[model samples]
Target: IISVGALAGMFTMMVTMIYSSSRLIYAIGRDGLLPRWFGHVKGHLPENALWTVVLIIAIMGGLVPLTQLVNLVNIGTLIAFALVSIGIIPLRRHQAFNNEGFKVPGYPVTPIISFLFCLLLMTQLSVETWIMSLIWFAFGLVIYFSYGIRHGHVAEKRIE
Candidate 1:
């Protein structure tokens, strides 16, 4: 039963991650942050975006060892979560949006604790993982500045 549960959980995570990653690429392309080809659809599917994501994943999986991949994924997940937690503080401060449903109980305190915990966990990872994450982040920054910031829909709209 334990093995079965673990297998199910792993499959669920894999499927959800694939879907989410493909959609993210599609959204970015649609926003003009990436090549317009990435946003192209065929048969009601974001085929180009999905193919690009799959190819990237295949290359990464082929190049990196399984253990390193696990470490990278873990660090990436933690960092994303930490960013989300940190973002909530500023979002809560802004009164532009209506608060209709649930709100975080402790506001700043809760997010602060979460961010600290994520950082602590990140510190426990290997130096190689940290370096790799930083490199990827730098690459993202380069992409954003070189193409995303200028060609992005929001930026274009703001200019006009």
Candidate 2:
């Protein structure tokens, strides 16, 4: 019963997440984040993004301890959610796209709930995991500031 539900949920979640994540990578690559090859869809999917994700998961699944991997995913996802909540305010005010689509309801409450939920999960992560996340974030910052800032389309538009 419970196990069946859990398995079903896991399958549903994985399929949806992979679909969404690959689409994001496809969009990003289309916007010139990675490479033109990544933007190309194969059989109605972002082939490069899907393959890259599969390769990464396979490597990590083989290498990482199951317990540590769960905690690591939790910490990473929580932090990303928290950042999304915080960053949305600025983006909403200075929107690049006009109100062509539906806007979020309960703006304040929504973001607050999202932030607190992320914070709670983040707090459950181990100190070592936090440290590792910090290191990864620092490296990401370096890459963003170096290559992304210099050559990013948004930055180019800003400069122009």
Clashes of each: 0, 0
lDDT of 2 by residue, 17-133 (tens): 677778877887777655667689888889998887777777877997877777776787787789989777666666565755756678767887889988987887889888877
Give the whole-model CA lDDT for all candidates, comma-separated. 0.86, 0.76
Candidate 1 lDDT (Cα, whole model)? 0.86
Total residue pair clashes for candidate 2? 0
RMSD of 1: 2.6
- Candidate with the greatest lDDT versus the true structure: 1
What's the TM for model 2?
0.76
Residue-wise C-alpha lDDT for candidate 1, range 1-160, written one tens digit per residue: 9999999997897777777888888889998999788888889888998888788879998999978888988899999999999988877777776665759978779999999999999989999998998999999999999998898886533311
Of candidate 1, the 10-residue stretch with the lowest lDDT total is 151-160
